[model samples]
Target: MKKKLLASLITAMMSPVIYAQPLPPVEVIGTPDEINQQRLSKETVQSNVSATSDVVEILTESPSVSVNQAGSISGFPVIRGLADVRLDVQLNGMPLLSSCPNHMNTPLSYVSPSQVDSIEVYPSITPVSVGGDSIGGSILVKSDKPFFAPTAEQVTQGEIGAYYRSNGNAKGGNVEVTTANDKISLTYKGNMAQSENMDAASDFKTFTTTTNASSGTYFTSGTEGTTTDKDEIAGTAYESINHSLGIAYKGDDSLFQATFSKQSAPYEQYPNQRMDMTDNDSNKLNLSFDKSMNWGKFNIQAYAEQVDHEMAFMDYKTSKQMPMDTESETKGLKASALIPLSASSELTVGTEIQLFKLDDYWVASPAPLPHMMQPNTFWNINNGTRDRYALFAEWEKELNPQWKTRLGARYEMVNMDADDVHGYNLDYFPTSGSGGAGNQTTDAVAFNNAKHAKTDHNLNLTALANYKDSDTFDIEMGLARQVRSPDLYERYTWSTWPMAAIMNNVVGDGNGYVGDINLNPETAYTVSANFDWHAANQKDWGLQVMPYFTHIEDYIDAVVERDFNDDFKVLRYANQSARIYGVDIAANRKLAENNYGDWSMKAKVNYARGTNLETDDNLYNVMPLNATITLMQAINRWSNAVELILVKEKDEVSEVRNEVKTPAYSLVNVRTSYSWNKLRIDLGVDNLFNHAYDLPTGGAYTGEGNTMSINGIPLMAVPGAGRSVYLGFNMKF
Candidate 1:
């Protein structure tokens, strides 16, 4: 999605005095040629963020991005062609440490969308200062920064707002009270939100196409079945409670802040997912401090977060499952510094470490095992941990006033370990549903000893050249080398899908499953060029176009066995060559701003194609051609904006059989806002036409051809949220 406004101040961005603080080596923020996403002129996360009206709504405007889900409220965000854990997620500059055993806790779940101050995404060419074992991209979700009181005004502040939705009787409210002085600052904020999603829409495409031979389900247009928004099960998702508090301090030379948050769900269910959870209690805490100096600045941060996810997963076939489970304890630490040696050169160095572990206590009561199968006798446990560390540095040199260059590199290493893995027996159970949660039978077989450990060496580099003129246009071009390490799940998590896709019948059995300890990282070589144009004091029109291409030498992926009739075949992680190419164009302009209501329009178009060199086919999940257009008329306090979005159906396939192709569709939305003094209200209409459709899931698994899943395995589709409304109120005092 293209934003309607650009960095319009060509003179301000190009002026020799870009910084008023005497040039103590300012972090590059105002340079339009630097690829900065916002106009904050500071490195503070708040300045780079784009406050998304809603989480899913955010992806509609982003290029080369998509989302998928089995329900309306929760889904996975796909960046580039990678989804799930392949993307790097940061909260307050620290990692959240993902441990989603069943992909239950998506990255977005770590923070509430309404509470986000900014969300800056760095596509394929991620900055080493943030990206880790990420393949698709990196996203930083920053909490709102403290709103300082004007030096000439009182040191008091407050804000309050409420939002309501139609479909699920959704309602949320927020209030903030703050006070700040010359040296100290503080803000306390709270919110209450809940939603009943029995009104969500169902995906029709999934109902018509299937690989099942025994079941005959047809497709018909209109409200043929249930037109309700959500699925048949009302409890698939439950109401939630959210609360948070924060404290901060700032002086002429130093800054410090801390935040505490809590979120809970009373009950949750998903027909598509075998396991159900009664509760997910999460507690999060973040703290960081930065010191500014004359020649350079140094930053440091420490964080700790824990999630006690208690869930009960069930197996339909055997009438057995894991109930009341717990996955607890995740922690980490990080620190960085920047130093300037001369008038035109600066150096940045940083390091980070994190450890994530899981403890699953499962018990099964299979109905077929015996007559009076004990309720909890069968017990099994799985304990695993992953440790990661990295060292990085980036340097910038000003070859001349109108030219500059940047170079960066990083070295990283990661290791994983698992114990007591032989806790279940599969000889008597062929599915995750057959035995209790403790009955993952494949574990008792001849397990690979090296599955518990892995080692990886990752490196990165970036070089750029820029041109700028106070009265003319500016452009920037760069070549970067970024590599993502294999996630722990891609390595040690054994037979991870049988429990999730057995009923589908098209899934592979873990009969011959072992991880490749010698797998290499997915490395990419990317080249990009972006240009920005401004018309001085004219109508203020700007356009930016960036085209990039990436080539991967050893892309790690799980390939299927060609000839295997055992239902499921040998599954191993292997390396392959892949190439991706795409172009992104976005423009914003004030068409005719004479006096007939300042007219402006914005548009963005992006397309990408990837191929697996080894298979001679399209990459598994490349994003299709997509675009968003918005037109608006502005008059003082009232401005109306209308948007039309188009997403071409993607039918490309690089995998075998070429069976999985998503359909095409379009969406429209309208937004209007009014402002008065320190108060403002905005309203928006999403999917104004209420169109129903299917979006690509940017993920692929081995199956028996394109016939769909044989056993009706519950696969989630990124269904578009149909016909919705949003109202936002902002107040400052």
Candidate 2:
């Protein structure tokens, strides 16, 4: 299978060269010429910014990057099949941590697409300068920088944009205002978005009622029986608002900036998880200074963030509402300097210190509640702290005019600990024991008695060489050794009770998970090679084929700790070995230019496979083979495009977790935009054929029914949106 896929990728890359024509160059954001990274083109970002509010969704435009569907705006960006905390995702130089156990408020969720000025992705063999405490990849999201007038006089400029989509009646808008002179600048940005539950093209479930014989049924909305419409996909509605303010000072050879941002999400329903986000509020402050010294460049940054998150079942799920709350505070400082060793070489050295504190506790149910949750607050994780200190250095040298090399090393010390924890109503289920109910007390006691603190010293190294064979061809190869310590929830979630274990699921797999403090940090050894073929001018056509492999030691996987009637087993996090390999093909060409417009085409294909060496089980949530092709037309002030997306059936399922398999599918979309002197209008249609399909990585559906019961509801894949027509307009002044 791997050989066949490789052959197909080679064929795709060569096809574009046959009909290539002169075109403009593709822009690389924030990346040097020697860096091996995938960048989103400005045109692509502008075209899709109005279609979706999800910031991570824009990552799909790059090769080997996918999204794990969750809430409307909180999709997890999957890089080379690795999702969530496994990847290093930074927003405006700050690494934000998700506070919720379910990862309901991901790092990227805080930023709207309207605020993005650039996105850069460094896959598999990432450089240590940009990667640390991550085994997979790195994503950098940067907003527009402070702008100043050419002269001393002050200048004011900004943008206002709004968009509406037919599906789920999604509507949103954004506003940006800035005032600047040659010496100082001030800016503000705000965004608001809301949507109703989206519908699928066809019914994907057999039963309308959310009930079964195993779990007792209950009345919903004052009715004896509740039914969901066949075409309606419940628990997909969402609403959110964000605001940010910035001020900057520019002086000769130096700059200083400060930014503050806040986010409020009243509700964000998730179809793949048992609980939805009832409320999430986050605030952040960032300060930075940049100076040009005699040696090179120097920069220092400090950032702080706080998150207050609450989760409960939405109206769609007629289950007992158990409120889960999480509060986290994060602070970090980073300093870096670049020095020129010689005319052909430069070195970068940096250090970072980060401290994270979290409190994940559940408010006890008051009187009249039947569950065992009453009487005492449940301390899932009290006074949890994860601190990391890191130092890194990278050296880049121009070996010759046609060859460049880079080497980097990073060392990180991670310390993690949490206070003792306990379940609710300890008196009801005494430590003496009762059977299923008594397990909670026993588990709590064991966890409380066990060691609660852990520290790990990790090291990472990366080496790369880029050989420019000619103006039209070049190849970049690299080797990397990366390391990542477990996150707070991955090592501290102690409860074995199904209810509590299930709430800690970050993958939305509808299964319970118990953490193990003994699990070792994951270390990955990776090798990657990229072959590039482009027009001599670097503008007519381009094709890049990259293949990579990674072997992970002490990979954090799960083993069945307990099973309830052989359904939805409670799994414990364990250290295991794993392997992952993949190939990515990307190409672009200028077909022709005529009175109709300048015709061009761009395409990307990604394939990945992962396996657990210990159990020989397929790794969970690995995305299936997928590809995207887009044809674009550009003339004067109007831009238009037609896109096609394809995905293969996901048959390599994870037997341990009973991961759902989705069928093969394809989709078509069309977009058109026109720009005038100060105004631009965009119109687009997604899923034009209204095809019915499930997201390959959407995970199992547990949105409704008796979600508290491990197996009360049938498992199914979350369906994709059917169709939507969107219109957007932006005015600049």
Candidate 3:
């Protein structure tokens, strides 16, 4: 299907002969307004494509945002030090969920950076109409808008681009075509990418090991003993293809658009998880409508998405190959309207409904295990379903020339259910005396009789105010209460055995987990503020500072479930109180300029701290204080920049999991771009200094085919990518 779509796009581009006018110059990249929500323009997306193709990587350029990478191509976006279910990530207003148990196929993984037109980030305080059941914030990614001819004439426009990187021998290409007439427009886009295993810096350490052999360590070795490669990171290769088609109709007062997209990732290896994604395929269909009315503007959207995912071990370290298959389907609809109440006030109201279904199971494999008494198909989660209905209303009032305020509220009801599940033994495995092998006990009756239906009611509220003290200074303060229901896997997974529990972990902790049927929803109360300072002219310099705090009533956490053996432990999802606080500071200034070029300097610093209030323990996978500085120079149509990134050593680690501490490191990168008429070229060298480092939140190191110990500490953290040069080009016709 991918090949066919690519061929069709190529054929259409070749047959096009109607020459309209030359395409307009690409938009220039600039910093977003400090007082308003941040946005990443199309030019910024194009500039970063040389470094990475993933949309999540591009988002990291924004202040207070970071990425947790599991492989070269798979990464999860962390906003304000929050990740996973905390943030609402949407593509063109459509929400996407990960189908993999380990979250290898995140929402952002579905859209390539080349296909994005813009990205809007609502940091800390989000409007109720955007989404429900989130605490961190919201990220909305918009693809290129449909084009319609202004006059009563038909026109065609398109672009073809390709890129290559030397680090992983990576190569990819993208194609976009659009045909528009007076009343209708048709658009198609296709992208394909593939890469081999990525290499680390020459001096990078692969693993940590102990000198003494007498002490038996559980965390220092792999489940199945393996060796590691120091120069190349194992299980960091991937290949993917995606295609999207859109059709739109435009009128004087109303417009309608429909889009269909298909994505297929043949495989993506995860060095942080025990298994790798062998097959991942997804399909999305969305329809949206907008109309102008006397009272206001009305909008409506409906979408459906389906995903089929599979995972397995492709190496020889494990005697048994555990292959898992999972499938998810999501359908949703949202409608909203903006109505003007007064000249200084506007009211917005919206409602949303979503239904999700999931199935998780493992097929019997050929490999045999001596620890198990017998083998059978494991029903991890059977017919799991989650349904949500929400309603929201927001009012924005410009109380006076100096003060503006926004008030919003939302109510949501969630229903979750699943069928009875069973483990391979169809029974509870006891650690002590038992009828099963290895002194294990099995109780099939208990698991099969467990209840699976649950429901939750969640309500959220927001109150925000902006005060303008002067032309050059402004302050914004926001207070919000948000709620999030437990995911299906956290509420419905019924297995307690090691293998069954480990398959449900989303965090790359290399540990097994079980779900609790009676867990309560998480409710968070937050307070945030942003201060902006700039020159009166607004072009020479600017400064912005943001501070935020959040307290969660029933945050989901893991509790160790003891078994008979001392080498292995199982974790069960539980509720606990937690708190997180952070601050972000950024500054940009036009330093100097000459006849030959102009120069500017920009710097940003971010810090976050989280803790389990009840246990007084540090939160897991929290990124430490980091800072970035950049010097940019531009001359005519060419732009060049150099960046220095610094990270502080992580000393506050998770006590529950005994998380490893990452050493401090600094890196340098350089990038340049040039454009001429219809062609554009981008060149970049990442990690210019060839520094060896690891991401504090990169998750556990599960790299196989290597020894898993460095000194005394377990080498369980994924290493950052090594130095690499990339080159790319694009031509529009």
TM-score winner, 1 or 2: 2
Question: 142-188, model 2: which lDDT tens digit per residue?
Answer: 98889998885889999999999999899999999999989999999
**Position 595, candidate 1: lDDT:** 40
- All models: lDDT? 0.56, 0.84, 0.77
Ranking by lDDT, best first? 2, 3, 1
lDDT of 1 at 203: 40
Superposed by TM-score, candidate 2 places the C-alpha of residue 512 at a distance from the truth, in angstroms, of 0.5
Q: What is the TM-score of each predicted model, taking all chains together?
A: 0.79, 0.93, 0.89
Please tell me which predicted candidate would have the highest lDDT against the true structure: 2
lDDT of 1 at 284: 77
Sort all candidates by TM-score, best to worst. 2, 3, 1
Q: Per-residue lDDT for 41-151 in model 3, tens only?
A: 888788887678788888877787887776566687787878877888888998777776787788888889889999988787678978878888888899988899878
Cand. 2 TM to true fold:
0.93
Single out the weakest 10-residue window by summed lDDT for candidate 3: 705-714
TM-score of 3: 0.89
